[model samples]
Target: MKIIVIGATGRVGAQVVTKLASDKENEVFAGARTPENVPNASNVKAFKIDLHDTKDTILSELPDADALIFTAGSGGKDLLQVDLNGAVKVMIEAAKKGIDRFVMLSSRDSLTPDSFSGPNPSPLANYLIAKHFADLWLIKATNFDYTILQPTALTEKPGSGKVTLGSYSSNENSISNVAAVLAAIVQDDSTIGKIIEMSDGDMAVDDALKNLI
Candidate 1:
């Protein structure tokens, strides 16, 4: 299977690239604005993709693939440009290119703009609002078989390959664990059209996902 991972140079995105590349049958195309930072490997290839570029340019850079995983963000810098509109642009391009599978890395409470907690009267509010609409647009407006993974409080802890899904998202979610789940979801068609909120838990990752069915 071939997969394109946006934000490939990012923390969770990098782990997803390496994890996907570990599978001999899988080929990973890593997309980043700064392509040089993407890791070099046999099954992994870097491509130039700037979310801030023209929509046509983004489409041109994105290669033909079986799936797309969107984890790109501006770290609260350019919320509208890089987070909301940027994501929608990629989705539009993916649809134009006939790419049907999509996976998004969103945050906890993104579905509820009011409940989302961040610094009082800060970008966090707008970030959640952006995510709220992005996820809604994917679900309501697009025909793609999409999976939206909403996790909370990403951490740097070692991955235990354990997680809780379907329940509300809350925990110190390790970036590794989140990446692993993102990797696994791309290969599982059952996850299509599902919105999964997850976090650290005692159940194995695979097991937790199976419970979703």
Candidate 2:
């Protein structure tokens, strides 16, 4: 699988890239603003994907990729630019290139955007507005086999391989754990068209994902 990881330089995105590249059968294209930071390995190559650039520019930089995994975000800086439009831009370009498989690293807030809906929702509105639209765009507009992983508040801990991969809720999830999920699902056709709400639990990662089918 030739996987293109957007926001490959960010916290979770970087980890996702590493995990994907660890598998010898998978060729990973780590797309980031700072491509130099991405390691130059035999299976992994750093490519340029600047969301700040025009949609055409971003599209042109993309290779003949098999799958495109979007883990990018603006981290509260430019939500519209990077988080919302940037993601949508990549999706459009990926479709233009005939890349069908896509996995998105979304937030749990996006699951209940109406409960936390509107431009500035209350209680659980951390990037809610942006995530809502971006996630919706993928579901409604694209033809890709998409799986959206919506995780709750994140923790800094290194989570276990076991996890609950369903309609479960918890305080926090490890970033690494989320990245692991991303890596697994991108290659999993069973995860297609599923909007999984994930959290930490006792089920093994592969087992948990398998149970979802």
Candidate 3:
């Protein structure tokens, strides 16, 4: 399988790239705004993909890929542009290019009122609003095989190699564990059309996702 991982320079995205590339059967391409910034790996190739680019340009840069894993973000800035608009644009291009599978890295509570944890107008609110719409667009506006992973606040701590899926009590997840789930789902057809909410837990990553609805 040929997969393109957007935001490959990011913490979670880099892990996804490395994990997928380690598989001999899968060809992974790391996509970033500045391709040079992506970590070097023998099995992974880096390419430039600006979400804000023209549709044609974006499509041209993206090879004929079997799936697209989007973990891009603007780091609390340009939520509307990079988070919402950029994501929608990539979805559209994926449709045009016949890329069937899409895996979105979203946040927990993005679709619920609880997303706005703070006051009415907070940065977290804006971020959740952007992700909410992006996830909605993927579900309602496209026919692609899509899996949305809504994990809580990400941490750099070593993964427990375990996770809780579907629901969780807190909004905290290790980046490695989240990446493990993403790598698992990228090749698991059963996960198609599923929206999974995740956090650190005692269940192994594969076992947790196997029970997804």
Candidate 4:
């Protein structure tokens, strides 16, 4: 499988690239503004892509890609431009190019009911809102096989290689575990058109995903 990973320089994105590239059967194109900075791997190829770039420019850079994983964010700046518009634009281009699968890294808060209406709403509400719209666009507007992973607050701790799908209470997930999930789901047909909420738990990543409804 040939996969394009946008925002490959970010924390979780970098891990996703590493996990996927380690598989001998997969070819990974790590897309970042500074392609030179992406991790070095035999199966990983770094490519330049600015989320803020024009649609045509971004489309031209993606070639022969079978799947796309979107993990890009503007880090609290320009939420509308980069998080919402930029994400949707890439989805549009990928659909145009006939990419079959698209996996989006989203936040749990974006879908939770009380996160937006409570007296003390999430400080990152704006960012979550952007993700909500972008996720909606992928579900309603695009034709690709899409899976949205909505993980709770992310931590950088080493992965336990164990996770829970659909729901969890701790509301915390390791970046490594998230990467493991991304790598696993890309090759699994059961995840198509499914929106899963994830967090660290006892079930193995593969088993958790296989049990998804």
Worst 10 residues of 4 by lDDT: 109-118
lDDT of 4: 0.90
Give the CA lDDT, 0 to 100, for residue 85 in model 2.
Answer: 90
Model 4 CA deviation exceeding 4 Å by range: 112-114
Q: Which ten residues in a row have the lowest lDDT in candidate 3?
A: 114-123
Score candidate 2 by TM-score against the native.
0.94
Q: What's the residue-level lDDT of 113 in candidate 2? A: 52
Question: Which clashing pairs does model 3 show?
Answer: none
**Mind giving the per-residue lDDT tens digits that candidate 3 earns over 1-213?**
999899999899989998898788888889998889886777788999998898888888887889999999998878998999999999999889899999999998777866476455445888989999999999999998999999989998998898999989566899999988998888999989999989998899888877777
**How does candidate 1 score on lDDT?**
0.90
| TM-score against native, each model | 0.94, 0.94, 0.94, 0.96
Clashing pairs counted in every model = 0, 1, 0, 0
What is candidate 1's lDDT per residue for 1-213, written digit by digit as tens? Answer: 989999999999999999999997998999998889997789999999998999999989999999999989988888888888999999999999889899999987788755665456434677888888889989998999999999988899998888888885456799999999999999999999898989988788888889995
User: Which parts of model 2 have CA positions greater than 4 angstroms off?
Assistant: 118-120, 123-126
